[model samples]
Target: MRYTDEELEVMLSNYRQLRSQLKDIRESIMVPHVIQDTNVGGSSSGFISNPTEMTAIRLAEDDVLNEIKNIGLAIENTYALLPKHKQKMMMAYFIDREPNIKELEVARRLFIDRTTLWRWKHQIISMYQIELEKLDSV
Candidate 1:
């Protein structure tokens, strides 16, 4: 169940993207779609129920949803296990990382040297990989 460091980093890097996708998916599933009736002169039963509820139920069974939920849950759970300072480092490095920011700047913001930043990243990714492995075992 061990992943290479590269693979672990790739997964960690996807945290924000996965979260955004999850949010979009949830919103799409929850909102009711307007269906246009094609019937011109056909007799109708006039017993139309709310489509939003039914749409949510059907979309809830999607395979992609399960995969995203499992991965997202594991990520959140692992993040929760980190110490407060490590959590801050993770937020700065991955979750809230801004474009065009360099590694040195991130280290400076955290008030740590480049070496400590590298070490902390290693530790965080290792913990995250273990969490993913645990998810796979289940």
Candidate 2:
């Protein structure tokens, strides 16, 4: 949803609050190893292999967790730039991307009637190109 300047302020505030909470959750957390590897991959029949598979897996897991945080930030920033009514729908749609979220689910989250949600989704998409252009110019 593209929000107006006023809406952007509110969304930015929301974003900051959410991020603060995330920070606390992140700090108290530690990556626990459920499994350990004893053999360091080597010749092992001279086949293709990674010795530090566990380490690689651990790093990949961290990467995915980081990606989640990054996506949240991106969504919030993008939301700030959208028009007011469109922001919720756009954010909802993004949230629902892949495996598709039910329309009702999106509507409930935004607390808007379904009809209004659909209308705004379309309206915002129609304005999407222009908004992208504006962002690009900036």
Candidate 3:
């Protein structure tokens, strides 16, 4: 199958939009909180049989970090192809090591609801997978 210039243009635009949102998503990983509770290993009666249990609380959406990595890579491949508006937004949102940009701020700045942000993220992952597959096929 083949894509016309318009279709390619739209796809590229969507990628940039998703990349912008993805930029913020990548920065939103929760700081890992390790609960270091010292179990005195008291009387054996009610012992933690294993003695230690570990759990993690992900404050932000978990998969977003993973998707950010994908978006970063795909953006690298396609960055030169992006328009200026998209380039700046995507770069600032995703690739920079600047201060943490809050999620609510990002949502408000993009004029999108939280759920739409999630859907955009999902689309980025799907599009990245498709692009990667095409490269692999080549």
For residue 52, model 3's alpha carbon misses the true position, in angstroms, by 59
Q: Rank by lDDT, descending?
A: 1, 2, 3
**Predictions in order: lDDT:** 0.80, 0.53, 0.48
Candidate 1: tens digits of C-alpha lDDT, residues 1-138: 677989777767788799788878777666637544555777884433667655665477766766787777877887899999989999899778887999899999999999999999999888888888787787
TM-score for all models, in order of appearance? 0.69, 0.35, 0.35
Lowest lDDT 10-mer window, candidate 2? 28-37
lDDT of 2 by residue, 1-138 (tens): 244644433433354455665565454343343344345676454322563564455555664355436435554556677777676567555443333667777788889888987777655544543443454344
Against the true structure, whose TM-score is highest?
1
RMSD of 2: 11.4
* lDDT (Cα, 0-100) at 34 in candidate 2: 39
Off by over 4 Å in 3: 1-73, 76-92, 96-99
lDDT of 3 at 87: 48
Instruction: Give me candidate 3's TM-score against the actual structure.
Output: 0.35
